[model samples]
Target: MAALALFGGIGLSEQKAKETLKNEALSGLLAQAIQQAQDICGSTLDKATGTLLYNAATRLKDQRRLGFLVNYIANKGVSSDLQLNASLDYIKNHPVDPIDTEDFERECGIGVVVTPEQIEEVVEATISKYRNQIMLDRYRFNMGLLMGEARNELKWADGKIIKNEVDLQVLNLLGPKTEADLEKKAKAPKQKAATETTEDKKESEVNGELHIAFERLVGAGSARGGESTNNVPPATATATAPPLMIPSVSLQPTQVSVPNFPADESKGFHTVPITSTIYIEQSDFREVTEKGYKRLTLEQSVGLRHAGYVISVQRVLRNKNGKLVELEATCRKSDMAEKPKAFIHWVSNPLMCELRLYERLFLHKSPEDPSEVPGGFLSDINPNSLVVLGDAMLDVSVRTAKPFDKFQFERVGYFSLDPDSTEQKLVFNRTVMLREDPGKI
Candidate 1:
């Protein structure tokens, strides 16, 4: 049953490898491209992006140049489907397109990564200009204004970062939420923070749950991907509570001096600080002796994201207030000669994000079947279908994504850029998981 509907809700990646596999003409090109993409990102190219491989392989038949362009497109792609389609169309129309061609950057984004400072400057300036309006509207402000101004300045800037910076700056300007604001937010239809806080308060009237919910609402929806688990040890925020982000985070970013790595593994370590000061998700670090945990547990060494190096956690460092503010780990340099058993995705200076984790709207696969679901499809609605992660730390690579841009988050799920995204948050609708769970099947 799971296999049957695996690709059912994939809005953009609907056409999986099977589509190319059935088409012998495109299959070989996809096979070749997938090999390259796997080496680069350890995943298959989004089927939507995979079309370029056919164009590159067929149009510009030079094997070496073909390999280079394919690699570039896989690593750094054009922003939207329209642009990707345009690139594909260009390759088909033109008889040739080498690495030196002017059309590469002109048509698609065959460019460099937009640095954090450059992005920060734009975000800071734009928010300062609209400070009064943003403060007044609070989360109700049309965040797109801030995003539009920033993106106008830097089209290639990570949309994730822009939204994060905007959220951070706005929240900072607004200060803490007043009870009136929370009550008003609670009255709002989808103001996630208010709803979650309300729910937590209901679960336990204790101040601790309220405090945790406040942290979750203010914290990061967060960046990159990391190993996720259901169980975790008790952890607290940093002594300097900059932004109360999530507990599901990996370790903070570190500088790993790797003299060399496999040619295909990385172009270079694009070290972007995911956060300042260290407040790792205790989930990323568990108590020692929890065998097969595969993260930075006590005495266990794990590799850091972006930068490649292993850090063995000697002990957990807490503040005078007993807050889990830092991790004391010993760094040992290592080369990415081959894929390590596990690598941790950490954020040193991460952008704040809101991730809307969606599930099936209706409980029954065939909701319309009265025989399967009593009182019809309407009654089979899944009330807890949407879980909002308001303060998620997100990678900036996804920052400049235009609305409707689709991506498969490494281990999380396939997500679509929902129209609900605003100045306060870049809302993503979870289209589907990477694959179906056997239990659900």
Candidate 2:
């Protein structure tokens, strides 16, 4: 009967590899049906015969029938290739019965025999052909419920066997009640009296501490550290603390060297014990203007003042015959056109020229109001003040001096390094022009 059922579902044609997979799928279902039939009949087939029939069923090209046969063989201990040549010959010779035909026709069938080993081989081949697909089906069934005709087939074959068994055991234990009713009866409400007692104890402790803190805060009022006194009286304000005394540490006297000469001593005359007649270059003379005194920015004034005391030196160069020769010396603007005697007197005093130079190079009109005059405080001076290439002459030694080098130019006030210095020529900016008034620069 199992063989018959398995063969009944085997409806596949062998043509291509894909056809073989279809055969296996059908064989699996056929095998399952045959097994279910055998179980229902309470009859067991020879294991080898069952296997042979399963093998034959799996060789069918129809996947659904092949799958049923494969499952039947699996449950029935049956091999799938049982009587394959015989079945094929039988199928070939005998005309399939219509649904109306009730009896088997035995007259026209060919009886060809097939070995059990052949059945097993066929089953293995069929399974190997569709191993991956079979696995996918198994995984799908396990993950969810089987679907389509397979689901109906399963329902008919097993009749909810697993669910029935589970329900029976549950009913035996739980008296056939609904799950919700069973759960409700199984649970018991816990007595809350012990929990309430614990909560009350905690609440009482919290209340006691809170009451104490509240009473303390209210009673203490503004008093923070110590206990408050109810009888304390407000008193009139009065000076109660004595003055704080800081001890004085006397510092030792510092002997600071004082510059003995007056800061502005243009009028003071010292006799020249030795006078050197120095050459004066006409180009070295600059016309002194009232505006020139105002033009000195703050930085130039400080730079000039810092160049130190000025001294006028002049010399008369002489030929081998002892004849007087004219020499050049730096002079201010007003003295440039004056007679040589007047130039001599002006250059003789250095402090007057130094103060005037400071006024000319450092002072300037305030930027806030151009007309407003301001002293040349170094911090306020425009940085771009000095013009290079102004005429000047110096001794041969001074001519080789580096640019911006500090020098006391005779009769030219004080000079500082200028950018014009080179191997060929040296130039200096008159840092300050001599003047009589200290406030000018």
RMSD each, Å: 19.5, 57.4
Q: Give one digit per residue, the lDDT tens place, for model 1 in 138-220.
A: 66677888899998897666566677556545644553344344444534333223211110011111111000111222121
**Residue-wise C-alpha lDDT for candidate 2, range 142-253, written one tens digit per residue:** 2122222222322222223323222222222222122233233334332111110010011111100000000000000000111112211111000101011111112111
Best candidate according to TM-score: 1
Off by more than 4 A, model 2: 1-365, 370-391, 436-441
Residue 177: error of model 1 in Å? 47
lDDT of 1: 0.46
TM-score for all models, in order of appearance = 0.38, 0.18
